[model samples]
Target: MGIVSNRQNASDYDDDMKRAKAAGIDAFALNIGTDAYTDTQLAYAYQSAADNDMKVFISFDFNWWSASQGSEVGAKVAKYANLPAQLMVDGKVFVSSFTGDGVDISAIRSAAGCNVFFAPNFHPGQGDFGDVEAALNWVAWSNDGNNKAPTLAKQLSVSSGDNTYKAALDGKPYIAPVSPWFSTHFGSEVSYSKNWVFPSDLLWYNRWREILQESPRFVEIITWNDYGESHYVGPLSSPHTDDGASKWVMDMPHNGWLDMAKPFIAAYKAGSKFPIEFLDEEKLVYWYRPTPKDVDCDATDTTMQGNPNNSSGNFFRGRPDGADTMADEVFLVTMLKEPATVEVQSGDISVTLEASPGVWSHSVPMGVGAQSFKVTRGGKTVDSLSGTSLRDITDTCPCGIYNFNAYVGTLPAEAAIDQLQPDGLTMLSQGLQVACPTNTLGASSASAT
Candidate 1:
């Protein structure tokens, strides 16, 4: 879902549409709240979608709007229902909401003056709603509940039960939701900010694999740009400067996550083995906290109000210490055309592995100085790049919250490759390599190019 709160221009929507469209997204489920500015920007978004031959629909934010009033939401939805870009499912206008259990959805259908295909995340602790055409679970944090849920088994059961139950009853389609990562340390003060990290360790790949197995009708990437919660898989240029949430991700390149998603989408649609199409080039997408969980970036805000694992509620029950789930290792998702030996070196430590083609990940522990990586084939280096320095305090702002941004760096395409030799090393084009520090760091050194 895309947030409409940012004061965007036609150019902004146009650019975002182009990016998402190229990535195999057909429509945008605009997650809008009750703000006058958002209402205005929504119009521009619809027009831009139409111009770009893309589809747009509403996923109302009842949390910010009047929850009890259905008429208000219907009226707002009706305004864009007739637009050329309005998303329609089997001739009915597609409609959804972030939270709308309190609102009368039947009344909303009547007020819209159109046949609405409504699927919403109306079920919290109250359980699933039978009235909607489909059900959505917006907050499936982790596959293994190691960090987010109580135990690994609970995580597996919860995911299995939620998907199985929703996809079975009524023969209705369950929207299979997949997110790359989750964190809200930037907004820990808010009620929803229980810093949850699903450990991107094979998260996107594994979740897509699960969703494909379930055979759900639709798939929704948790968010394109919910910058505060930090599951954003899109560019982070939009400002959530009000709470200084932008500082957490600022230039941290999460775009590679989106780029990596293209292959997954192709595989999901094809319903076959995911093809590693880009064999001509290689790229590595990696992320990690620069500092360990025990290391506090800010010493003053030690009240520990935002620790997700330590919170007293069911949503926040996991670890009593509320520590981070990630290990002190750089998680690597590499894109390769063929077999190659990849090396992650820092200080005196260097780990090498024989990597095959497709999306494979490996965790390399942090050492010292600036971390660097190299892709060697037949004993010759093909790709190499320097990453962020492993500093004690990587975060710029000494706030109590954690800095979860991953410092990413792509291997330069122009880098020279050694010539083929009889010894067996062959000349290969440089593949991309990206990595982040293990401690708190400001912004990102990652480049999309």
Candidate 2:
């Protein structure tokens, strides 16, 4: 996210920082254009970013700033020789939040030892800006950035726009910045959609997903703050915490965007395609399971929140990496049944699941891949499933990383699964896991055909 105009001063930035770190936020300094302080202030914000662990962007919000700042914006950012070249936490790097008319960004990239990312100020979620000019400007910005190469282009083959971003496609280097947001009760958020998060009225999830599909490079999630905008996906809240289930909504380093960002960044880094569920105007991603239980278990033990052995395990409830979500009255396929004779290939046998109504999970040790499973029970027969291809999954939510992700296709349904998508993949941290409904999801309701 950008600067909180009121919090330009380091001390004042506390609230903003608190919010940013909340829902899984990564910080990008946008002080360049604020014109909020003097040369000393800029220097201070620079140090403040370092102290706060935020990467300073040459936002130089100069387009409309006072003329005096206009001249110094570029030079000032250039002057900060020691500022972070990339986001200290996620490695996105110091960049220009403000596009249009700037210094030779290539020179800046070389100086920073990284290619700069471009963050355009445009989101219908916040409020439509009336014109596509900003979008057009971003496109222009990409072409402009592309004309001149930056330093790290050699080391990293990142692009400003992979596809959705027209500018980058024209040959720019900045990743198409897609600001993913979330809303949680405790100022904690991942999407603008309300899950006790920031509220919105758009299918924001699908909105951003389209954006991600448009770009193959970076996609910056908007604000990392539970900033009061009802658009906050960060744990930063309104000086209040809602006690329903999640406590992080009120705390940080304990709960906030920082924690949420890990899974997001990882998902993107892994190139996992996000599986989204509609939440009002905002299309939000799932952070916590409807119930806190093992994805494979149908049981719930709310009293044993602290019990690791309990099916309601403290599994991250997180989506990135390997996380298992507890489903109510549902069971992940724990024991696979062989319907036919087993055919072992080489040394192991592959088993295909019959998850038309259930999800299956796999339990395997690390360093085990390109390997198959064994199925032998009372002369039970096992059919072979394919482990040949890995799906090129995209982030359900966009973050600035060329991530890889995937999910298995579920049985065809008559309609979109209730509350959940039929094709959604439940992440499992412990064993290889998949989720299936004991009953058909949204069997009666079709997709409004």
Candidate 3:
């Protein structure tokens, strides 16, 4: 669905209806900014939605152009806030600000309302949306800031927008907001918009495709009338201007923007079976937080000689003198994004140990010029080498005989890992190494070499 929450004028509804009906838009969201709207005005907006057969949504950017953190902040919000629990004549709930916690939605949803949508933090930075993971989760959380139900866009913004990633945004939602008219940087020949062009917007489309590949969220187009940010997809004309320099050129969007969206929407629906976005792939529509781990495993419980029964980690190449104990689950892949450290004690020997973070980081030393386990870190995880029958000159630490492990497959492009998964390792004491054959190995002459 495409959302245009900052709209004004009663006639604009007629115009929007006319345009949407002709455009084949499945639905459109409107932002009814405040309760100052009379019952008649509210009814007009809904009636227009019904007449056009367009699924309608309403919103209010309570903050408008005000700072969210000013001392007058709450007061300002109160001034423009909708009646604590008032419903529009259409009985639909609307948002004042698209940001997650701007209003208490859960409380209002209990009122007589039709539908409600949330517009989580938008247009942050030039490269992407800000607080990406938070934004992505909104689709699942219904844009609930405090875990409120009946959240915003319970699904996704198949056509919503995030102005421009002037920042780094996690592409959980494919939706983006566009207002070509407001942007002097795009769609205009004005000296102000020297770089914004049909091509500039392509950056977002391509980037979004990458994020979508990881999750199943959709996209959103921000405003249908916001022609100020210079990122608008609509006309950038000032109705009050008479001179040719300050007037809007009608039907400009019909000229090109829709054409750009058509093939894209079509291919997205087609599921990338025949899609192209420089380098496209199947996309994800949703995501859940990964399994959380207890980072503070044990500040003083790890053994000097780690467990030998561990298959996850089986390569030992440590003793760099200040070595500590082993960790649980953490590896090169995830350590970087969320690093961790722990300490273990072995009677009078307590050491704080830190893990190596990176793909194929901290190689393993099988023994005597030979290594047993290797990992690749990037994207997901993979083996440093996925091979079948191999011949080694030194049969050192055969199959499952090592005492160390690290993460793999958390690096980029030049993949050291191809197929194998995390070969986690644990430390084994010299005495214990001697006690366990599988945990220890001696160099042996190999004929396969």
Top lDDT: which candidate number?
1
Candidate 3 lDDT tens digits, 189-290: 221211111212122234334333433344445444443222333332212111111111211121134323333444444565222331122111100001
Task: Supply the TM-score for candidate 2.
Answer: 0.36
Question: Cα deviation in Å at residue 81, candidate 1?
Answer: 0.6
Could you give candidate 2's per-residue lDDT for residues 222-274 as a string of tens digits? 44332322233433322222222222111111122232234334445456543
Report the lDDT of model 1 for residue 258: 75
Q: How much lDDT does candidate 1 score? A: 0.60
| Candidate 1 residue lDDT tens string, 4-44 | 44445666588678989988888888888766677677888
List clash counts for every candidate, in order.
9, 70, 76
lDDT of each: 0.60, 0.31, 0.29
Q: What is the C-alpha RMSD of each candidate to the true structure, in Å?
A: 9.8, 19.1, 24.9
- Judged by whole-model lDDT over C-alpha atoms, candidate 3 comes out at 0.29
